[model samples]
Target: MLDFFRQFISFIPPALVPLALLAIALLLVAPLGLFAFNFLAIKTLFEELRKIFQDIFKLIIPKKWDSAKTLIWLSVFSWAMSLPTRSFVQSFIAFCGWLLLIPGIHWLMHEEKKIKEFLTIEKILIAPWITGALICFFLFATPESLPGIMVISWPIVSAIIAALPKFIKSGPAYKVPDPPVRQDLIIMVLFNLLLSCWIQLCYSTQVWLAQYPSFQADDLTNSSFVVKTPSNESAVSQGFDILRQAETALKDSLQGQSWSQVERWLLNFDDRIRDLNEQIIDRLPPKAENAYWQVEGRVLPGEYNVQLFAVWKGPSSDNLGYHLAKTCQISQGVPVDRTPWQTLSPVGSASPNTQVDTATVSCEPVTKRIKGQPDMAQ
Candidate 1:
């Protein structure tokens, strides 16, 4: 009875798995949204939200409940929510520092008369800077560099721009006059243009980073074979062992060859690897089909790196009516190096929208090494 049920499930399309999971999630979460809409009546919710917004507005701008203060706070909140948590915290600290520092600087410079004007300008300029910084941070910065770059660069640039006018006016030029409002508007526009250019550079760097594939040594050391049944474990291991032998043979044959010669010999090397993979599959208890393997070789001055991929289909366990395909790859002919495995087609199905289930073990190389040791030569 169990076998019959498994057979029925094996016939289901692989694409349906994601749809089923999504359906389950919606089924679980729909009631919560409905509950908020039903038990908490829409009219009551809106009234409560309005009160909450009023309270927050009063807290941020305690003395003045004007449209300008409301707009400033709204911009701050919008910018804060767009950032990742760490960046958001740093931005908040910078914001508080800006609020305190601007007044202190004005007081020390005996420019208290212009403090209100400075506050108004700062609030107006800050919104656009925050918006531009966040846009660059998200679209340009890689996951590793996002927080540090955003935290360090953004606040410093903002402080410089805010203090620039005071610095110029304080200079001992024969009673330097306050620039016209037109000049202030021009400065703001120019600063925004400069920020836009900086963002363009960051985006260009990100594009360059995306062009090349990363190679890591750990990806090779930690590679594993995918086996759907316990009985197939030995077969998978044997296949890997055969692959290692073939890799060694290819390396020995191609050693000391120039790049041109290696390129010429690649076709022959691939044929040999394919033959060995077939032999490995033939030895397995379950009949293997749609079997294929690829060998990639790169020759350096003193050493060469080789990566291998082998994929084949075998009889599924009785529970699944369709065949099960096992696909795995290993890196050999070098001490430590790995290339990411590329899937040519969905492992077992051979064609799109097929019922066969694929079991894939993808290898990702980790490049870190111990202290005092040289990094793995990629």
Candidate 2:
């Protein structure tokens, strides 16, 4: 079932995913828009929403008088509905946002007992759940700064918002308190707007990085056989000579062999080359630590391709290593007639059968630092 949902989301364009998340964030905070327009209308809006939800859930769970609790549950319901549709990181941020609201809801519920007229609509509308959604959007937008922002700013801001009423009471109480004109409400709205801008910045950074990553040149070089060494001509020449010698020896040894015989002969030849490589590395200078050579070859009917890789620790103070690869190919050997003389006696053949014996050789060189080795020149 989860896989089916994932497949459905996969059909949506990659660029649309983040936009959809942003849309959801805006939708979650749509109540803030209403609160900004007229605080009284928010109360009416929530009253209607509460009644609708109570009717819908009446069949499952009995409706209670705790509207604040119901609003909190509805926030959780929003998170649950969005979680499965979003990516793992987005889902995690949404979950954290939900977690951040629990304390705020508990504080509001506790404060309702002390205050003579608890502003239920005002408190519920600007709850930590809404702020958490804004924070989640910021986190998804700017993943690099997520930990710092969440750890440093989140708790401090939440605490101030939770203790806002007490701070206001310590000053002077208006005959009729205006929630919108409150200092904490103003700060919260400004902070949320700033966070929205931060989200935009993060999204832009992500797009830039995706288009031009830090190590693009290095990635390209690694993908191809281009050599970085100062001198690759000598290595390439040597590889060609070595491949020519191997091909000459092989042709002489397996001139008239069948396909099975040819395969066995090539296997033995490979083993001999392996032993030779070990011997060659052993003769290298003592400074060449972790020195090794690798020889690989492929044989076609009348063609052969070979590659030799050489790697050794450099004599640099940092214990860096050097690596080089040379590939060579021999192709289109002349084919010779191998049928016995008596087989052609009935026809009294006068023409001597043609054979292909010639083979061509070519080599190319590549160089890079050995794995786990530092860059010596750098």
Candidate 3:
């Protein structure tokens, strides 16, 4: 298991950094494009519930009070003060809203305490039940910041709405019964489904954060990163090399020319490189800690991969290590076959299929030589 975790940590996140970025990007962008789709689903469901409410009113109450007006007023009241009110004001308005909905309105109009007024014989059950269901559907959905009020408050209101009808109609001879378990169940399911979907939406949006790349630890700090950059090179050249290598690898791995593919590759590629960059620093002693790399994942124009860069400290790889790191690119350098984190081969080594086991224990960076001289490598 320890070996498993070590191996697991070695490459999956890094290998699929490009893919993961694409998956996350899709998660964010898809829902936005499909926002209207979910909205339409909610709207259709509410319309059906509203139709049911009106029909039920006609069946039970001969003198039907158009309660939809009251419902609208209640909603307006709930929203008006709900968002702006804070601390005491928030609580005060809520208390008044609760009052208007119950005894106060019933007394003002019907001249009866709400408890008794609501218990009147002619009151219907189905309409209120449906209304409660609708309210429940909408309530938990809202990602509003102070959703504390709605989260707890609306459930009570729903209970009241679902119950008032049956209570009013049932006489002492017949106690008001609970809303059918099936009806309650359906609403609960619908509410849960809505909650899941809404949460997914929020999750997608948050996933769109920009991915900044790191090259190396400062002259002294030993930060962890995946890809390292050549420190002595001009900043522009270092960035270019990282970008070029990432782009080339992506085109080769994916073997597709689509821009979408390229964009996704870059994200994952950079993440893996960052992982590699950090591992390099972890092994260094605190003093002249020089094995840090720049970390970046930039989207290329009309390309499917992001270019990544890493910088190293210490002796050059040519002198200290044998194989020179060669960037891979697909045909015409157009399509990206692999990304930054796609498992890399050891430089100056003969094996092409060496496994990139645990990142920390598997690989070590041989510092670049002081100059580009090949003789110094021996």
- Top of the candidates by lDDT: 2
lDDT by residue (1-378, candidate 2, tens digit) is: 999978977988998988877988999899898777787778789999999998878633425645445556655665776666668866675676556455435545454554314534644534544354455445544645554344334544544554455445644762433775566656765775576556555565446434323112122244343334444232231223333444444455555545445555556756765665655445433421323233334333334555555443333212343344455554544465656763454365555563435344555544443343322232
**Model 3 Cα displacement at 345 (Å)?**
48
Instruction: For candidate 3, write residues 77-172 as lDDT tens digits.
Output: 775777787988876776566545543333333432454455455653233333444455344445445343344344345556554444454353
> Least accurate stretch of 10 residues (summed lDDT) in model 1?
212-221
The alpha-carbon deviation from the true structure for residue 320 of candidate 2, after best TM-score superposition, in angstroms, is 7.5
- Model 1 over residues 143-210: C-alpha lDDT tens digits? 46664455435644554455455435444543433578547755755665576566666565445324
Q: What is the TM-score of each candidate against the true structure?
A: 0.22, 0.23, 0.23
How many clashes does the backbone of model 2 have? 6
Worst 10 residues of 3 by lDDT: 357-366
User: What TM-score number comes out for model 3?
Assistant: 0.23
Candidate 1 local lDDT, residue 209: 28
The candidate 2 region of ten consecutive residues with least summed lDDT is 211-220
CA lDDT for candidate 2: 0.50
- Write down the lDDT that model 1 would get: 0.44
